[model samples]
Target: MTTRQNSSADQESAAVVILGAGPAGLTLGNLLHAHGIDCVVLERSDRAALGARARAGFLAANTVRTLERHGLADGLRRHGRPHGVCEFRTDGGRFRLDYGSLGRRELHTVYPQQDLVADLLTHYLDAGGRISFGTEALAVHDADGVRPVVAARDAHGRPARWQARYVAGCDGRHGAARRSLPPTALRHQCDHGVSWLGLLAEAPPSLDAVGYATHRSGFAGHMARTPEVTRYYLQCERGTPADAWTDEQVWDRLDLRMRAADHGPLRRGRILRRTVVDLSSDVVEPLRHGSLLLAGDAASLISPSAAKGANLAVLEAELLAEALVGDLAHGDATALERYSRRCLAHIWRAQEFSRWMIRLLHAAPGTDGESFFHESLRRSRLDSLRTSRAHQDWFAENYVGV
Candidate 1:
């Protein structure tokens, strides 16, 4: 395996240490590095395959602006597609919410998460940022006099230990850094009881932008990565296996849900990738404890339905970096003290919106007519969102962009 060489001899303890070199960690590192702060990031995987894992692909207008302001948007603009609107379709008809109608600025970007990560990593490396991949952080001791030791083995399976004044747990949900926090800190969690089977393929995009379609059979959402590459998601019951349905079967089902009622081809492509994941939202209070702080997926989760996870993560990292910079400059932790509450103010809003969206689109199990109720509720929400300029503006400001 290929690896980036490290010169740890003169690499004294860094001012800040970041766990997991994902979007959140890298974003925070970039911001801090720009301010002349030293930080070391530990990632469990190697470079060249950072975002190989399946995850969210859409980045909202707010996230786009954040990236652009942070100097990571130049490469993004070169590779991403700006989208104006997103539509919801059902057997009754379709309702489209044109974000452009609500605001003069563009709304969202149809860029894959991997593509965004790749671009950010490239820019980050060129700027002299260092990420130690294939290195695992075994434990975090945040007590006094310890300086928080991060134990791991290097890419060649050599043992390594890193000590830093402060540690940022920007790792994902499953990483040990988040688990290191006391169990009581986890304040809220809500499971939507549904799963989305994501599919990636190199085929002609079916729609001009993002499309949300609902049928009696299920729900299907389509997004274009490029003119030739498309990303798709099909709603399914929790625990459904991808192998249970053949590739042809999956495409046929997608066709049924997304095929235009006007007799238009929804576009078909060969499957490139697929995975299923349960939808859930979680937020841990007081994002900091001792010398450790949680950011991104480690601190909170934005449902895929909301299309805000990556955006929220980016914003969170930005906030944390700002707070850290203030702390370093003024010898005050005021911003750090306010970190969790400030971040939560935005997080809970997204949580509510995402939950509302999940309830609006996903089919309910059993025979309570829950599906019918949700469908009606969705239509009502769409009408209100479209007709009321004030409401639309609120969404455009809060949910869409900077």
Candidate 2:
């Protein structure tokens, strides 16, 4: 937990400077360390805060393979659980899908994101990687030049400068990386007009499989996090506060929406966390500007409907690391030249699937004819998924592909 503080004007140097210590930055740092490349990671939060943040838990099969290939799967392999089933409940009835048995027969690995981040941090440190836990990157300057400068401040409010051959912007959507992008950058964005109240409870999962319930009231989702913890999402109005409802009211609404009378009772416990997440997606074209390269949410912001944000982050990190290594080690810039195109292809694909999942789970909040029409379409899509193998295969493939 050593913090770097420098009030002097002298600049530190590394081959690469990574912003953010989440999955993407840590993955890139670990890979670079293994390749004997010099790199430093800068994170705004302290070590404890970084390791305690909770996020998506579902890891697609391909994501698991990527981690395994990089020798980064030890934590997941030791504690992750394989999950392949998802149950859907609607007014018509309830149906379940064993997604692992369909399409390519792939499954997701359930590993809490906080634990995964802790593991990545440990691995990176063990490899002698340098990470400034409480340092904040203020701006990236002169990225168009061969040498870029990262202006930052340490936890003690002391100014610091980092000069690097290259900069990797893995911070996040609102981080300095995105803020420093030039006006010429192309940013495509969409708002799905849906919001959800995400909750973490200290209760066991109501269902063994992932549960998605579509009710006239709204949508309710249930997913297991750990043996004693469960994740839940309740469709909510766009401006509703996270604490809009009491615990008893929350459970009552969940029961009504999930039709617990016909199904079963949900295990109840203390609600540990609550947050409002609006469904939106955005992507930055090229994903690179001169010496600065972007990865993770800084490159693209995908909704959590499909659990693709973190998976995409790790995938992009690997691609960028390989390209960086090749360029620095052997002066081969082929991979580097095509890194944006390669990662953008996968990012767009995942965005499409995530948008589709958002539509599948949420009904547009309205009583107009257009709203009714969309609801019918949603029902039709669910029916096809329930009755048609072709539809199921398509859903299964996209559901776990990214």
Candidate 3:
């Protein structure tokens, strides 16, 4: 591990300062390092914590390409599995879509995010990249000026300052980057009025394809992580505690909602982790503000319905890295000027598709009349997906393409 430098005595300097060590920050760091750009990654957690944090495992085709282009994808290419089929189940019946056969024939690479992060961390360190783990960025000052200063606290509780030519805010929605945003920034927010209890299980996946089950009780999802691990989601009331249900109760509910009785019993095991995720979406307009730029969850927060978060993060990081290199290395600012517009276009499209997926997989909660109306619309959408090749193609295109 690299020893953190105490900055209280004198301000540290870098060409760029990256906040957070997740996909977006690390990707940006690696790309910038490859281009011989001087940068440092500041992370709030220690190295072990960051390496073990599990997150979205699905990697869009574009994300894979981005990693490959920068020589950061070897780990995933060696360990990740290519997945393309998803199965939907409702009262009507069950059907599967071989999404890889439709549209552009693209497939998602299933690589657990923790593993990917560890890979990126290793590559960055091996290439002599600097990272200050256990450093929490407190705020950004003078972002509107030529040089920005990041106030942070080191793991040993010492105050530190880093002056950088540019700052990349990839620390997430509630990170210091967002907190430092000026009042002039516009934030658009939306709530879908739904919640999901995300679960990680030690058991193997019961089905070969990703499973989406819609029952009167609620919605249940099944996604395989590895041969021994599976991820599941159960629709729950808003504000439900992650530990509201016991492991046995969770399995029973999953079985009922997933119609396992009609199909087959799910392979059960110990619940590894649980969390309640609110189905919400938000976007910050103008991802760039002077010397500070936002990427990943800092720029936009999309529901996990479409598995677009990490994909979008990789995309934004690539774009930002390229634009930064252009401006710093060649003195060209054209790409930097157009970065926000380009990223926003993709963000909006992914948001739309994610919203559509949310509506399709979960029935609205309300009176019987309201439920029936929403259910009808959901059925019609499913019917189109099942019967119309065009609709399936569209779903497949958006499902794997971000």
Backbone clash count, each prediction separately: 1, 0, 0
Q: Taking the tens digit of each residue's C-alpha lDDT, what string does model 3 give over 1-402?
A: 112334456588788999999999999999998888889999999989987787798999999998998899999999999999999989998999999999889999999999999999999999999999899999999999987999999989999899888999999999999999999999999999999999999999999999999999999999988889999999999989999999999999999988998999999999999989999999999999999999999999999998999999999999999999998877889999999999999999999999999999998787698788988888999999999999999999999988
Tell me the tens digit of each residue's lDDT in model 1 across 1-402.
012133375233677878888889989989988887778788888876686754666688778888889888986688777777777777657767777667555567777787777787777778898778888776676523437766666788877877776788888887767767866676588888888898887787887757888777878988877788788889887789866677788888888888654636667768888888688888888788877888889888766886778888899999999988888655778998899888888888888878877866765555578766766776677667657888677666555652
Per-candidate TM equals: 0.91, 0.97, 0.97
176 in model 1: Cα distance from truth in Å?
1.9
* Residue 94 miss distance in model 1 (angstroms): 1.8
Q: How close is candidate 3 to the true structure, as a TM-score?
A: 0.97
- Give all candidates' CA lDDT scores: 0.77, 0.91, 0.93
lDDT of 3: 0.93
Instruction: Give the alpha carbon lDDT tens digit for every residue of 1-402 in model 2.
Output: 112334245688788999999889998999887888888999999989987799889998998998899899999999999999999999889999999999989999999999988998999898789998789999999999988889999999999899888999999999998888888889999998888999999898889899999998889999899988999999998899999999989899888888999998899899999999998999999898999999999999999888899999999999999999999877898999999999999999999989988888887678999999998999898898999999898989999987
The runs of at least 3 residues in candidate 1 whose Cα sits more than 4 Å from the true structure, single-residue gaps closed, are 1-12, 103-106, 143-146, 261-263, 369-379, 382-398
Task: Tell me the lDDT of model 1 at 118.
Answer: 77
Ranking by TM-score: 3, 2, 1
Top candidate when judged by lDDT against the true structure? 3
The alpha-carbon deviation from the true structure for residue 57 of candidate 3, after best TM-score superposition, in angstroms, is 0.7
Candidate 3 versus truth, CA RMSD in Å, comes to 2.5
Question: How many clashing pairs does model 1 include?
Answer: 1
Q: How good is model 1 by TM-score? A: 0.91
